[model samples]
Target: MHGSRSGRHRSDPGVAAAAGDSGLKPKGPSTLQALTDLVRLVGRSNAPQLRLRLVGAVLLTLAGKALGVLAPLVLGAAVNSLASGQGTAAAVGWGFGGFAVGWALVRLLSSTAPQLADVVFAPVRSAAQRRAATETFAHALSLSLDFHQTKRSGSLSRTMERGARSVDFLLRILAFNLVPTGVELVLAAGVLGARYDWRFGAVAVVVVAVYTASTFALSNWRLEHRRTMNTADTEAAGVSVDALLNYETVKSFGAEARSAAVYDRALGDYTRAALKANSSLALLNMIQAGIMNLGLGVMAVMAGFEAAAGRMGPGDVMAAVLIMISLYAPLNILGFAYREVRQSFIDMEEMLKVTRQTPQVADAPGAVALAKDTARRGGSIAFEDVGFRHDARANGLEGVSFNAAPGTTTALVGPSGAGKSTIVKLALRLLDPQGGRVLIDGHDVRDVTQASLRTAVALVPQDVALFNDTIRANIGFARPDADEAAIWAAAEAAELTAFIRDLPEGLDTRVGERGLKLSGGERQRVGIARALLADPCILILDEATSALDSRTEAAIQKTLRKVRAGRTTLVVAHRLSTIADADQILVLKAGRIVERGAHHELVAHVGGEYAALWRKQTRGARART
Candidate 1:
């Protein structure tokens, strides 16, 4: 597609109006903002080579448009000279051949110059797209966990994908095609007016104005249809990815047909919306073509009359008609360019919204890393009157306070909704308490950089989500610089050595998507191995052994006991047996700690929450046996 002579980003207000602004103004952290950043990036790059290419691109664009306009004039002049010449036959032949060659050469340069310009601008475009994608992706990742919890994986991925591609499209269409096409239009009109009758230029000007106006109007109207289609597309993609990711659940529940039906409906919605958009596009194209051809016919008629009256020659008539034809050449993509420009803006706008998001949890200004000596001492954790609430949940932490001395174990166990997970999250600085302070080694976690805090802490969750990669890569992810021997040691410590050695590929075995290829016990072991590889001062196990079978659980628990030395450990376990030996067992009720003591002391208290839970579990186990 193409654009008009006016600056679409500034002069034309429809695009901006459609986006609830004016002319896809390079404002906000949107596509236009990306462009603004791109310009600043190029200027700051200190690479004169890129600047030279940019300048070369501009010169070539103008040179291409100029040659295009001159080519038709040369052809027309040749025809006029041949007809009026009284030269010898050989002279006439030479004159005809010379003009033909000259026209072809001009035409060749016209086409080649634009292509060469694109080649010159390729690096700039690539860099712009790469930076935009990297910036948005990094920003999204940096956002708080709450943001990700509410976002659909498929929809977010699609947005980032489309937005990245949009950067490339916008740069090309805006810089090379639409912007230059508009310039070419003005140049063509000026040439027509200067070399021919004033009426010819007037016709060219009116045609462009009307074309640009109508195209923008129709494209603006078409925007809703595109949006509708995109919504459906995103929904369908989200549904499919969600269902596939949980295919095990779907099959276990016998919901395959239901899932397929849902996807089918989503696609049906998308198809209808796409059809409407495509139909609107066809209508716009027809209108554009009609307007362009009408102007051409009018120019030809005027030229013909002038020729008949002997005011102009045959060559002038040909040149007059060809000028309008050549004008339509780049203007041909008017509708497509305007439509895509708006759509790309929308896509990039969505992605940029992510980049603009303010993380609920951010490091305090002038935050510093944890003291190495303090971290080496196992990073003491103290929760002083910490409070947090979830709007949707009935239970939340309330003045929760505890201190885990360095190199000791503190266990939290309670019924569901007791906030064990919330405490874990707070301790990791994944979330900040709404009130009160969470401190590590007497320094408020908020006062230190998150990176440093995380470096000293590691958590092994109940369900470990792993990347689809080799066992070696997954285990080594926690310590990217860890050598092969370190990885093997960690794996061996997690009791994964035997199982991994049994596999044909050993550490090289692929762990499929989300590590689904590995059994729950195996995945848990890999998670433990990864956490172990970090060699963190503080270790958090949130039901880390819940996925393992009884035998594996016992083995892992033994491994954990051995590895707990010199590191503070926080364990949240449903199976009371696993944490029975913890130095301190805090029994939580609702969101508050109701009982705090050693396991033996808590079990000694008759009818106490911990004692009751211990009896119930032991009784159930005896009954099952």
Candidate 2:
């Protein structure tokens, strides 16, 4: 029943409270203030989500306290009547029966209210958590490509997963454990003072004070140990995920024993940390038991003295004893609850780090939409003395200037790590240049919207990535609304239509993760088909045909020639044969362009870098044949 409602609140809150204004301060005076701040955050736009559950939970708590106070009084009355030697069985029986009913109400109200809270707040918590995850993921997508290049996928995934799950634990502690314990504390103190003498009330006060202090101290000790445990668990999870992802590499190198040794170290750390946490909790429980028993013993002796002096009746003793027992039950849980609340804060902090981040790229106020030019002069790319570097590195590209006129092919030829890819990335606006500007059709890329920029360019990567879906879906990814005929036309142009048609399910066959079901050449062709379907103004091929055989590479090159009539095409290739007929080729070395000219002219300069690369590539082709 609770799960049913949780599924209903999955819609995104369209109007987000401005990001990072949650006003969470670590320097709070009391737990109450911290809880209030957290509640205010979760309830910023949707006031009803917190208000309804909070009111219901408080009312239920009052109901439980009221029943608890009454049950003890009834038990006291029955004991007094019997002690006074009243010759009335009906009266005593009625007293006992009333106590039973009151006890039942206490149990029902306390237990049922928390369960109801879970049902009510479950949906709201889930929605908030979903919003947080989506916002983080979208922010990551908008971040500069250099940020992604330095981070590990497995670690990032674990961080987000744990951060989202933290909300559920926090809600449960707030709704059920924290609220009820507070109510129980107030009711116990009130009952002791009202019905018994101040001495007895003082006993209740001192014992409760000591119990709370002890719980706090022991819980803090255990919390430190639990933090260690959590670290070990995260490390273990990271190692396992990394090993599983690189299983093929490990197997090829016969590193099974080495992998096992690493996994065992992670597991050993986790086990040691867990054992320390459990042992500390067990010690804390023993202290709690000792304090509770001693308090009860003192109360028992005091009641006996009062009875002997004829100042207090047997009923008073019964009432005092029952009240103490009732209070002790919740007190027992307080230690563990405090520990959990502390752990929850650690989890919450991880989530806040992601939510509080400001994305490097955000749309400016009143930003202009990018418009494509279809006049006689259209689809041109220009780089004006651009300089770039990753945040952690000193150099990526420096003082580079270039232009690709409309309706022409500009090829960049360079060895690996020579900044050829960086130039292509700059043209696609994947990363903004640190020192200069990239212009598309005479408009700065930063001045336009991200959606418009993405729509204006299509990139074919060296390693084409495909989702585990139908072949048709993978090819039509650029334009999901493309009709069957348009998809078939693009596939035909890329020379992939015949192979797709030969499959039993034709285009419906599942490609599997990263297109594992297809060969390297087939995946490259699918990527080309996707790019062709988009038909963007600027096309980028970054070693797009490097994975194919000579024949397949020649076929794709011929197809590209026909499609390059009126579009700006930028090619980054290692094979000189692929770009031998390009209108112009730029040779790059160590983040600088050392040579730029027609291919034949570059080859004629025997000392030029492009000429050396062409000689090496041609020699490799001869050896392969």
lDDT of each: 0.83, 0.74
Question: Per-residue lDDT of 281-373 in model 1, one digit per residue for the tens?
Answer: 678778888998888888899999989999888998998888788888777777778767766676677677778899998988999998764
lDDT of predicted model 1: 0.83
Alpha-carbon deviation at 454 in model 1, angstroms = 0.8
lDDT of 2 by residue, 1-625 (tens): 0111111111110111111112232221245754663564566525355667666755765665566666677667656766676557887667656765665665566566556656766666776576556756776666666667776786666556655565566676666656666676677777777767778878887998899899899877765565666566656666777787777789999998999899889778867876676677678888999999999999889988988898789888878887788778767777766655654554455545656666566566776878875652338888888888766556578888888888788999887878998898888877778878889888888888878877878999989999999989998999999999999999998999889889999999999878978898999999999999998888899999989998888898999988877778899998888888887898998788899999999999999898898889889889999
Q: Sum up the clashes in candidate 2.
A: 0
State the displacement of the C-alpha of residue 498, model 2, in Å, after optimal TM-score superposition.
3.0
User: How many residue pairs of model 1 clash at the backbone?
Assistant: 5
- Candidate 1: the clashing residue pairs are 2-333, 4-182, 5-182, 16-21, 16-23
TM-score of every model versus the real structure: 0.93, 0.87
Q: What are the RMSDs of all candidates, in order? A: 4.9, 6.4
Candidate 2 whole-model C-alpha lDDT, 0 to 1: 0.74
Residue 251's lDDT in candidate 2: 91
